[model samples]
Target: MRAVILGGIARRVLDELLRNPYRTIELRSARNVLAVEKAMDEALKLFLTYDPIEDVSTGTEGLLADLIEAKQLEMRVPWEESDEREITVCRAKVKLFGLGRVVEVERRERILVAKVRELFPHEMNMG
Candidate 1:
């Protein structure tokens, strides 16, 4: 359950980060980044070995839904201007801020997409 929530948070964070474009956002949380990274790895692994389940969706979709239902994921990012922001999130703890370097949005998208893709790609009717 933690992994699932972390996956939802990671996707939420990255998606929010990318949408801002040309801004430096500090993602702070009580949950360490290792949990988020582990979630990503596990998500990728699931995509790699997913068994088709009729009328159901797999991968991050379910995670996202749960995050939405649980209200653990913030849909709107807080905007900061002229100064760096320090936010204390209640969901999880994290000391590692992955966006410290401030990469381009395109590159960030590529990195995220690559990270989420299955190790072995195959057509699955997860529904």
Candidate 2:
């Protein structure tokens, strides 16, 4: 799948490259939005595994990121759990950029997003 770098994320990625010389990452815009959405829909099913309504807005931030990053394109949800009344599902599609001039992130219950560069854990050089 082809991807696109939003605006300014090159320098940060370059710096990261220096740290992890062996690591590699690529970003490009999606060739087809509909297809991505379709894939995301299928990916959403994986959320059910973390069920127990009380768990919403809980942990599992990495679940979504890991799925798309892991490339789990297809999944299944039980028919009984498909009903909104039985289970409420919330999801968002996120794209990770290999680099960025500045990373904008919001972390409360979980890592809302870490766009353009490294902003996870927020311990070192998080400014």
Candidate 3:
């Protein structure tokens, strides 16, 4: 496993991961989108975690920045969990840009995209 820290208290997290007795994961950092694409080319699984930013509507509260799509990714929800269903599966894909090259990365897993709608009602229109 590999851990990539992209800001937001990353140094503290790096310290904890480095202390792992098993040494099972590798630590990496991508300073920019181009570097991130290079890292993705060599990665088997990519996990993106987010940190919220300040929002005026919330009065000092922070909300996750809306940058997924801006990062050359697309998320599609075929269905959502409801009383009739117990599980919701989502598909997410990202396009990595290299030096005059483009690579597409895809992952299908159990993710709740519906929550995004609740969080960004003004920005999300899943219709």
Candidate 4:
């Protein structure tokens, strides 16, 4: 069986907000879409480094679904009060076993930050 650890980008954004509340509006702006896209791309790159999935395999699809589900769950149980202007970002950290012992990381984002590692998973020490 495989194991998955889930987390959201909202947490990281929230932390940033706590440190600099003024950026909240800017973070949600449409202009930040590229940043968010880059973040997702980076996340995918990180995932593939450990677990490379091909076109036909359902692994990528399933992993994406799991990541989205995890994000939804995280939203349902917010660590702080929900705000209308606040956006939640979610992602997953997946572990595959058996013949393919690999780890995958996925991330969702609402804003583009120059240095955001909130959704990135730590290096796995286990094999």
Best by lDDT: 2
Give per-residue CA lDDT, model 1, range 1-127, as digits (tens): 1222232233444454335422222334433233334444554211111111221222433211111111133333446542534444324322222221111111221122112322121332222
Give the alpha-carbon lDDT of every model.
Answer: 0.27, 0.29, 0.25, 0.27
Per-prediction TM-score: 0.20, 0.18, 0.20, 0.18
Candidate 3 CA-lDDT value: 0.25
Best by TM-score: 1
Q: For model 1, give the 10-residue run with minimal summed lDDT.
A: 62-71
Worst 10 residues of 2 by lDDT: 44-53
Model 2: residue 48 alpha-carbon error in angstroms: 21
After superposing candidate 2 on the true structure, give the runs of residues whose Cα lies further than 4 Å from its correct spot: 1-69, 84-127
Candidate 4, residues 3-117, lDDT tens digits: the string is 2211222434333433442232222223233333443454421112122222212223111111111121122435466544345443323222112123333223432122112
lDDT of 3 by residue, 72-122 (tens): 332343456433322222222332211010122222121111111112334
Instruction: Estimate the Cα RMSD of every predicted model relative to the unseen true structure.
Output: 15.1, 13.6, 16.9, 14.8
Model 3's number of clashes is 0
Two-way lDDT contest, 1 vs 2, winner:
2
By TM-score, the candidates rank as 1, 3, 4, 2
